[model samples]
Target: MTVLVTGANGLIGRALCERLQQKKQAFRAAVRPGVPVQPGCDVAEVGELNQATNWCRALTGVDIVIHLAARVHVMHDKSADPLAVFRTVNVDGTLNLARQAVDAGVKRFVFVSSIKVNGEATKMGRPFTEADAPNPQDAYGQSKCEAEQGLRQIAMDTGIEVVIIRPPLVYGPGVKANFAALMRAVQRGWPLPLGAVHNQRSLVALDNLVDFIITCMTHLQAANQTFLVSDGQDLSTTELVRGMAQAAGVSARLLPVPVWVLQAGAKLLGKGDAVQRLCGNLQVDISKARDLLGWVPPVSVEEGLGRCVRG
Candidate 1:
């Protein structure tokens, strides 16, 4: 019942470590060199994740491998060759680790993927489902799709169990990136004109994601399967902001500005990328996960958002 968690110091990884610790599970945390080791868990530095050497070291005595480590960035990448960089870290690195894990006789390999494999929703009413074909629009999302294909091939060849969990925007205590920025804005009582926007997006609580990950571990039905999971709830931008404000003990005086205005302003100010994210419908349906895993997200959206605001 031993497990190895890559990127254990990350936002979701930290939550997963806490979850495993509470369950009294035997776990090992792996991170790249120079990142601080997670507290209260057995930790190891696997050097460069891209390099195959010493990868076997982390796989030793590991029954389950949760591959969470990958190249991630929050903004439009400045690199001239972002895909090359992403491939080296996300695709090649993933395959290298999986091959090594198979060699180490690991029982299960759980890969945490992004919902962007389906496509970041472009409109409020168009939510992507598991049946939708992968149409990754960005370098990061495309790299994840490539990784999924590579993992599937490796699983087919090695017979090692592979369970892929693709989750949409996940938020909880200590979450960074977009969710953190929203919390900071609300904490300062900064005004946001997003009340008028009705874009619905699916989100996962860190606890729920961790529970789903554990369910995929050694679950006979999860072998060679791909599933999308979320909180089983969708919230509009206005509702999300109001909930966030309430969670942070702030006034819910959200401004109702036009969505086109936001888009126009973002474009005029060279913030079109921001507009794309703020106004998009990055939603996913989780019926497949429900039916296949017989699992349900325990944390409600309100409860999850409250934890983030409190932090």
Candidate 2:
């Protein structure tokens, strides 16, 4: 079967393509503006997802479309209309491609969604399930929530199977953004006083996530289903950093700084969000994927972190 992967140059996308290549499967990759292409993967660029011209050519002979292109959020965005922009690209653009996929007789549409789409629940220690209420707090998450709604409606109308994978804090080799920063800091041996802080966050390895994508590609149980995936294990912040440092062949210079003090300091510096992320409650329960799909995450948390460090 032929498959199409959007955002093929991205961290997750690249890993997914590598896995698909290993299986000797026929796959096509969609590259958008500002994203580069990897070696050995069939590359196709569509200028804009909203325009009909963009959808017309990309969907030809495409049996499956894994929609990963979206307007990701950033701290540097100064736009007051971030939500509008997110909706345009994520919700509208996503639906445009889905429409084309249905027209092209594509069987499955796998959507990569964020854990934040279900809200940033912190500290109660309860894991979010597929049946949990969607309470997205930010514009980006809201846009993804809307995208899921649109996809669901189209699937019902067109009988195109839609599978949504919600992953939390994905990190691996060649990662960028916050994960890159963490690696840089670990390599530099920053004496962070964060060991005393305790928070459990679910993180997914890139390889395991890619494996999940492959599983969803042919698993009939994935159709019309929403899955929350991780390494199937949760890691605390201190454990994560210490593990990362160890994997990097460095020592974690973590000190015992109380979570309350950190929050107070963040409030004083107007970095409340940063504080929240560092000591926030982000967790998920992937029991459904295990029970229904008979799938297992291929890499352990430590193994994945080790690969990132070695990379």
Q: All models: lDDT?
A: 0.85, 0.87
The candidate that wins on lDDT is 2
Clashing pairs in 2: none
TM-score of 2: 0.96
lDDT of 1 by residue, 1-311 (tens): 79999989898888889889999999999987778855777887777667454776677899999999988854867888998888888898998899899999998899998887888774556667767889998889999999999999999998988999898888888888877887788778888888898787888998889899999986788998889898988888888888888888888667899999999999999998777777777877788878887998988988888877766
Residue pair clashes in candidate 1: none
Report the Cα lDDT for residue 112, model 1: 93
* Model 1: residues with Cα > 4 Å off, grouped in runs: 51-53, 122-126
lDDT tens readout by residue for model 2, 102-152: 988999999999888888874556899899889998889999999999999
lDDT measured at residue 8 in model 2 versus the true structure, 0 to 100: 85
